[model samples]
Target: MDVDYELIRTREVRSQKKINFPDKVQRNVSFEHRAHGESVEWHYEENEGVAVISNDRLSDERYVHIKRANVMDDGVNIRPPNDLIEDLSRPIYKGMTTVYLAHEDMLEGDIRSVYLLTESQAFTLIGERTDDSKELREVLSNTPRFLPIPE
Candidate 1:
């Protein structure tokens, strides 16, 4: 499907509190809803190149409430430049939002770890959501013979 992938920023916070632990965290914001119609999640990401969402996607009764930000020790070393997926696209704004709707659910996780984001640290992830959304409707309007989009 023709999915309009976008990242939307609803709010931004410069945390006054800091946490020191296994890893360092910059900023954190909590969302009210779950990803796949169930389960809550906590997104753990770095201020640099590494972002990891730590949450339990297994249970329907649990929802993640991002308590606060954390400060941690220095992380692992870098990888070869060639091994990295270089995003040469435009400069993503700090509070800019993108929406991608689809006929079927695209994002499997309620929480996503965004890497190499030079701007905002935390924001809402909107894409291939409901069946009747604009994203899904637009994709259904066309047909592709080439095959599914490349990874």
Candidate 2:
């Protein structure tokens, strides 16, 4: 599936989903192109090497969406993306799913190779690639260094 994730702010979502997640938290917002009425946002928490699904959401206008998945040692407790669940316990796996990030080599993009980033970095190579350098660093500065995903 070709998902063109748009980085929107809480304000932009006002006319869209209407739900307000904490700002500065990076999210891979998903929307159905054909069906313009429905939308879902996958809120994730980036741990060291793992991106935890803090919440799997659905729009009031739309229903057929995979709820959030939880990552646990023995087994996952949350709902899995229908396509992703091989009837197993893996919570978050974007197999074949594309991540739109400019910095495909950074710890964030390294979590998933097919990432989405800035237009400039999309074509260029190397060094501090993110949606916006100033904005990204600002976000990172506030994010706690719990478990930084290693390179």
Per-model CA lDDT versus the true structure: 0.26, 0.29
Alpha-carbon RMSD of each model: 13.6, 15.7
lDDT of 1 by residue, 70-150 (tens): 222232111112212132122323233222122222233453322222222221122224434355345433434111234
- Using all chains and alpha carbons, the TM-scores for the candidates as numbered come to 0.23, 0.21
Best by lDDT: 2
The digit string of per-residue lDDT tens for model 2 on 23-137 reads: 2223332223344322332332222221222223423231223343332222211122444233222232322221233222222321221122123322232233465745654
lDDT at 46 for candidate 1? 20
